[model samples]
Target: MSRDLHADRVELSIPATVEWLLLARTTGAAIASRWSFTYDEIADLKLAIDEFCLTLVEGPGAERLDLAYYLENDSLCLEGRTVLATPGSQAASDSGATGAVTFSADLSARILDALVDEHGISDGPGDGAKTAWLRKKRNPLS
Candidate 1:
């Protein structure tokens, strides 16, 4: 197994533009590689982050994007945050305020489901701020 790269947790904040998303991909790949992820796994992690950002960028307007990376014994977890366009929108499910955030039934959500091992969204720390997260486990061979 790979050693933890983000024992203290790492964060990246950038403008919500598509061009800046490359930074996220780059950061993700570097962290995954440092943690001994396979080439294929690193590529998958980059694509997963790209798709996740594309989804959020295309949907609502976000002032900024906040991403947090957590390295664990067997997995790397990424958390993304942004302010929602509508606080009362379908961002949260109808299941009574678990403060969960969800992607609209769209292509981005489908792509995310196919790529990452696990991914989800939730309310951020600030008001009207929402967050999405993805977890990619290290390959058993690593």
Candidate 2:
């Protein structure tokens, strides 16, 4: 069976830093709200993205963050990709690094899982790159 096209598709690429997270949040909220997601749902999308970025900012070789938003039937799907810092390299030494933040992968995953209906992580095309995704379905009650 042929699938329907996305209602909308947006892609953004920015430096992977805390200061740039606002852009991601704004884009997500705009898309979600335009797609008829409730206010609460929009807030959840922003929060989930904030948390997701926190993990990426701390990742080694995370120089750039790329995100794509797709509006699917009854759901919004977001896919993110970033290159990982090479092993044994001090890629996290820049001023962007605040203190030593030890974030657990499992913990991050759990938080994302709670925020969205579905979440996924996988290896990117580039070596040492990682890709993460989240999907939030429109609430039937809303």
Candidate 3:
């Protein structure tokens, strides 16, 4: 029997406009529910996703954010790629908050730490990363 249960991937190209952040967040939140994540787990997943998206939307004039979601039977993987339009640092997400901090001081690292602590983080292809293909169902593979 194949170990793969089933998976879905959703790719959304979001304009770096601040308004679109909510849309990206909502889309991620909706997808999380499909795997039976609890409320807090769902919220945490959304926050991690938003932070990932924020990383791609930082800077002064950028116009796009690459938002990706990989859904499996017991896990949800999210990745966001951003291009800064100016000569400054990128935005980062804070711990426990479903939001981003522009030009964060170590908050970006915190975001990764939090996600890893909560779920577990993994690096993806060049310039991209998988926040956590968090394993929610302990025995889903069984």
Quickly count the clashes in candidate 2: 2
Q: Please tell me which predicted candidate would have the highest TM-score against the true structure.
A: 2
lDDT of 1 by residue, 17-129 (tens): 66688998999999888888899999989989987766555444465677888787679889888744355444322331212344454767787788788998765556556
- Global lDDT of each model? 0.73, 0.75, 0.55
The TM-score between candidate 3 and the true structure equals: 0.60
Winning candidate number (lDDT): 2
- Measured over all alpha carbons after superposition, the RMSD of each candidate to the real structure, in angstroms, is 7.8, 4.9, 7.3
Off by over 4 Å in 2: 1-6, 83-107
Instruction: Compute the lDDT for candidate 3.
Output: 0.55
lDDT of 3 by residue, 6-122 (tens): 466778876666678788878877877665567776787667666655554443344356766776445666656553333354333223122353356268548655653434344
Ranking by TM-score: 2, 1, 3
Error of 1 at 52 (Å): 1.4
Where is model 3 more than 4 Å wrong at Cα? 1-6, 83-102, 117-142
Where's the lowest-lDDT run of ten residues in candidate 3?
A: 90-99
Where is model 1 more than 4 Å wrong at Cα? 1-8, 83-105, 123-128
Q: On lDDT, who's better, 1 or 3?
A: 1
Q: Note the residue pairs that clash in candidate 2.
A: 60-85, 61-85
